[model samples]
Target: MRFKSLKGIQDILPPETYIWQHLEHTSRKVFEKYGYKEIRLPIIESSDVFTRSIGETTDIVEKEMYTFPDKGNRSITLRPEGTAPFVRAFVQHHLYNEPSPQKYYYMGPMFRYERPQAYRYRQFYQIGTEALGTEDPKLDIEVISMLANILKKIGLKKFTTEITSIGCKECRPHYKTALKKALKNKLNDFCEDCNRRYEFNPLRLLDCKVPSCVKARTVAPAIIDFLCAQCTHHFETIKHNLELLNISYVVNPNLVRGLDYYTRTAFEVTSEALGSQKAVAAGGRYDRLVKDFGGPPTPGIGFAIGIERIIPLIKKSIVHDVYPDLFICSLGREASDRGFIMTEQLRNRGLWVEMNYDELSLRSQMRKADRIKAKNVIVLGEDELKKGKILIKDMQNKKETEVALETEEILKAVSNKK
Candidate 1:
């Protein structure tokens, strides 16, 4: 029997990984500019961490999480998302005690058991940021603006920002009742999953992918109609601040996010380039998440971008190649051994170099270098080793010359050309 990887999982092989590296580097630079620090958390956590913070009725808790029992019969789960684990770390590590508003950004894999299509996978990566311990509406505006800036930076031009407020705890119940009444007679026409959502989390019905549910909710009551005085004021302030920053957006009443932790000011960036599953990034304010995780009363707002979705969009829009700087090609056993050392030296100088040490022929090694799109080829033959010099070939210009293999001379040759 041939074994295969589990479905809905993908391996990010070499050539495609260049896109990921670019995205990660850009994300770190933007987050640092906003005064956010990187935080790493466990990929697996106790099951209760998500159930308590993400809400039991949410799809992530009820249907999607990958949970199992350990040797001690305690339930542990591979995290289905990033926010809940970070919140747990925030409280457990006592980060809240040090500052009023702690900003953190994280990028990693999250697991969920769901049908895979297009960019949706059982194990996928996300880039997210969280601002904890602030209730100011300016924080909401900042979070949304940062997300928009990232999308623009990534070269996604034909995208739209859809903004909404799901209302706070005080007024959500009223909207829930109104939403339920609108779907009461037409419940059977919707999918079974949405039928269950009606009883537990009626708001998620707006985000349903089913054609029947979407058509039925066309005239349904929006959450904006039921917002309490405070939530209403906060939503308006977020919009006003967005206007001040010249960020264009459309108010989407039916934009409740999948996670239950979100309280107010939910937003998503969608692109027509990705059909059906159009959302490349989405998030909202979860004001009560910290308190739910046994921390102080801290209000937080943030966003998470689906790396898989964004990478595809970027590939379509951008035209650039990420290639190795140098390819160290060697002949004979002695030259191959010295080639490894030369590769390490070049790498220490912040240059990407590649070489294979299985003692392949000169022609085979050169072919491999070409496949990797190496900019220059450094030939370390027995003759060059004896002379303490090497032949350097500029692959792009098709020029060859002899240069001293010493560190200083090689550095000067490469640096001067650039």
Candidate 2:
């Protein structure tokens, strides 16, 4: 049989990876600015980590997760989403014990067994940030503002922010009761999934994207109306703070997060450029996830950017070519050996460099340099090696300079450009 990548998996090869690198770098910079340090977690986790934290009724547990028995007959799963694993790390490592609010960010692939479409893939990447151990509404505003700032920094400004408060333990039950009551009258009109959601998580029905379910919910009672005094005050304060920051948003009563652990705040950023799969990023506050995962009570909020979705929306010319600072083209046996050592020495000096060891003509080597878009080309011919001098050509400006082949002279010459 011919080998191939799995149906829903694709390689991030070549020029495409330039965009990924830019996105990851931008995310790290932004997250670090907010005091969030990077945390690396295993791609596979004990199945219970998700089942216990993500809830048994959610689609991620029932339908999407890639779970299998391990060598020890223990259930292990490829993480379908980031938050559960992030929380697992927090609780397992006792992060909350170190400080009042533990902040972390991650960038990596997540696996699921779902039908892929548009920007959604079975194996996909995400950039997410989590802030644990705080409940101040200003933090919620900060997260939303950060999302807006990140999208703006990435050149995705033509997007809308949708925000909502789904209430908390004290008040959400009442909203669920009201929503279930209103949905019951029109339950038959919704899709099968809606009916299933009705029986278990009634709040989820409001966020359903199904055409029929969405139409049916037009008459359903809104969750905002059912928010108790405290949640109502909280939502109002969030809106007031958003106004203070001049962050435009629409109050989406149906913006309930897909995760079971989320309480109070939930928000999403969408773009019309992405068509029907409009959401490029989404997240919310999960105030009780720490305690649920065996840690002391902590309040947290975060957001995850769907990297695949963001790639398309990113404007062209934003991700530039990955060009090496120098490419060395050498001819003759002695020149090649000397060129190779010089390549290593230049790299040790922290300059991006590339050199060919093959027996290609100078023209062929230049072609390779052009393919990689090298900024500077160094020509080390037999005579130049014998004379302790080399030829340098700037690919961008079409300028040429000759200098002593010593590392310091070459470094000074190349490093002097604006």
Give the runs in model 1 whose Cα sits over 4 Å from its true position.
Answer: 181-196, 208-215, 317-374, 377-391, 400-407
Q: What is the lDDT of residue 409 in candidate 2?
A: 88
Compute each candidate's TM-score over C-alphas: 0.87, 0.91
Q: For model 2, how does the per-residue alpha-carbon lDDT over 301-379 read when each residue is reduced to its tens digit? A: 9889999999987848475745698999999888899889999999999889899978899999999999989999999
Query: How does residue 257 of candidate 2 score in lDDT?
Result: 75
- In the range 4-110, model 1's lDDT, one tens digit per residue, is 77899989985678778878888888898888999999998999999988888777898999999999999999999999999999989989986767999999999
lDDT of 2: 0.87
lDDT of 2 at 378: 93
What would the C-alpha RMSD of candidate 1 be, to one decimal place? 3.1
Q: What is the C-alpha RMSD of each candidate to the true structure, in Å?
A: 3.1, 2.4
Among these predictions, the greatest TM-score belongs to 2
Cα error of candidate 1 at position 38, Å: 1.0
Could you give me the TM-score of model 1 versus the true structure?
0.87
